[model samples]
Target: MDTASPAKWVPHPEGPEIAFFDTETTVPSRKGESYSLLEFGAILVCPKRLVEVFSYSTLIKPADLNAISVTSVRCNGISRESVGSAPTFADVADTVYAILHGRVWAGHNIVRFDCPRIKEAYAEIGRPAPEPKGLIDTLPLLTQRFGRRAGNMKMASLATYFGLGRQSHRSLDDVRMNLEVVKYCATVLFLEASLPDVLSAATPIDELPITRTDTDITTSSNETSVLVAHIEEMKLDSSNAGTAPSYTTVPIIEGSSGFSGYLEPEEVMTQHITVSTLPFGQFAKMAVYHKDVPLHLCCANLNVCFGVSTKFLDNAGRPKLNIVVEIPENLCKVLDKCDEVAHKMSQEAGSISQWRPLVKKDGYVNLPTVRLHIPTVANGDHAIYSTEMYQKESSGNIQKLVFTKVDASELDTLFIPGNMLDAFFDLDVYDYQQNAGIRLVAKRLVLHSK
Candidate 1:
């Protein structure tokens, strides 16, 4: 490894292009293990023509070769032998910084993963990391705008969906593929936006009709069932609804952030139990979210066996409601199924809502957890909210938790964070305001003492 450190980088033109980049790192073998940088690849694209202006890619000799496990090699095909003679990241930091700093940054899921890894690399080398003029995470951006039509937002899946061949997983190849994927998706979206009626009639990209049986109920009065009323209504009115409901701007509901289909605690609980009647016997049970499976292709159902903590306004720019809960492994499998089903549906619908996976990194240890995003809608003058809050009593009666905004503000809350509760929910899909994907909609919940 080179011992000399690269000098601080200064952009000559102060960023006239969009910097698209990707990084390949050693997969952490154990919990809390930091990612070791293995490679860096980037390309500067002309914003006007959407063509590549400059490209750079290099393999980096990690600080510790032992960090590169067999799994890591399998993931990216980069082995210690391949990078043994490569330059260290410290040697190329200046070039990487120069190509990145002050430019609009674009990459697949960079905001969640790559961007952080770059910052961490800089922090390790005791240098200031590059800052972007604007950040565009293609994963969420496309998942939002392009929809899941191409399946999961992973670069490999998107490439395959568009018949762009395979993803090499190398930093340079991946970044270039990322740009191409974005262009294809943007073109499709542009065409659809320019002509909605024409596109709607065309069978959605990568989707077939889902033939759900009428065995799926359509009543709100049921105690443990899915309210298929809206699904049925959509089927009946779909001929005329013509994307109206999906983008309905019928004056945002006073308190409920414009979210419709609001259900009370009992109503929510019934819906969960109702849809979950698909019987299972031991190993024959089905799952939605599997760790090894792509999220858009699978689904899941989770049981929050622990008490929940409910709070308001914890997350900025979102509704004040949040319910944090833990997913027991047994339920994680089912919840994964919900993810798959909802993801496939969202893609077929060409909806723009982002999918939030139930099983996250650092999952499967002491029970993986997920947040129940409860966006409240108005009920007359009061702001009423549906919660992932569900209760199961000792007698086995399941109930949902309904809280008013005033009740949440009081903080003498029924669903306290960090407190365990018995809850039942479906990983249902929603496309309100073009925000699509699966969420844990509580059909049943139990609140313990105080």
Candidate 2:
């Protein structure tokens, strides 16, 4: 995939139409090579009934014809000869813009792949890329609400699962398949929801999927996607300073600085730390505790060494948002001790997964840095940041930021490299599929104004 940052979208008019689109690009032959746009196709559909309103498809010739490789032809069958007589992207930018701009853009995997190509295509022509009013990425949307029922959740697999026919690997065909797959999935979910108990069994564990003993895709935990309201932002008025900690047990962890219930690492004693196992039905969870209370730390003025990263993704293709920050020795000492104790406890608990260190030494200078995960949970048809965020002005005034939309671009803006923040986080230990580690899960972040 291309390493170029995807373009951030600007607001568009609130139109009744939703644009379902796809792009076919040349497959890069080597690392750091970018994709060359070959074809673009889109269909304008009514948001209410999802019926087609307008359609457009065109082949775009790349500046360098040699960019089209044999591998690229095998992937999408867009040959250099096929597009040699076609209009270049610059020649057809106006048509593409008219078809896409100011609509709710919907596509599969476009967030990671096609969006950047579109932006770069416009940039190459020294033109502005058309922006969407909102986005509806069918990839994460289906994966979250529909689960892995259709296997890898790709358009091809989903089309096959629904007997919708083979994917053409062309831009126009793929977009149509994406919409049909969504419709079929939605219909099944609607029928299942009407008879919830009989169609799906109720289990004590909500997060755990209800499935057969064998590996069939049918699952009872089908969550319906709801209508999304407008994205609204609100600044939190005040922190509940005297209130109890949300993540920890009673005997609140108090601090004068930052938010309540977030303790500085200097206030933590290495000797007081212990890992305990708590039973949850048939499973047990290992947790780090300071004496008896669950341990969490808050550190101010941590410099960001690396910005928000979406390179790592969950099984469902959801971006695992995280950032790397340089840590102070005081914080490092406390975390190192915690890692040692937690790794031992995880092994004792019969976790066969390999242990990954929490504190990492990067570069030849060996600076101690830690990655703080900003987790995401499902909303109506999208994923939103689970971490609470606040912005602290140079004047020392802090206001919390509340986001209802699923845009990860906002994170790229806030968590730029070299920015400073006060981090309040907890240790989340997990052993899944032979990989295990204590993840520093951020609960609240107060971004400092430069």
Best by lDDT: 2
- What TM-score does model 1 achieve against the real structure? 0.48
Which pairs, if any, clash in model 2?
Answer: none
Best by TM-score: 1
Return the TM-score for each candidate structure.
0.48, 0.46
Tens digit of per-residue lDDT, candidate 1, span 52-137 = 77777788889999989775786689899988998898888888888888777878756546776798889889999988767766
Give a tens-digit lDDT track for model 2, residues 126-175.
99988876676666566656766665566777777777677898887788
Position 341, candidate 2: lDDT: 94
Off by over 4 Å in 1: 1-13, 201-450
Residue 254, model 2: lDDT of 30
lDDT (CA) for every model shown? 0.55, 0.70
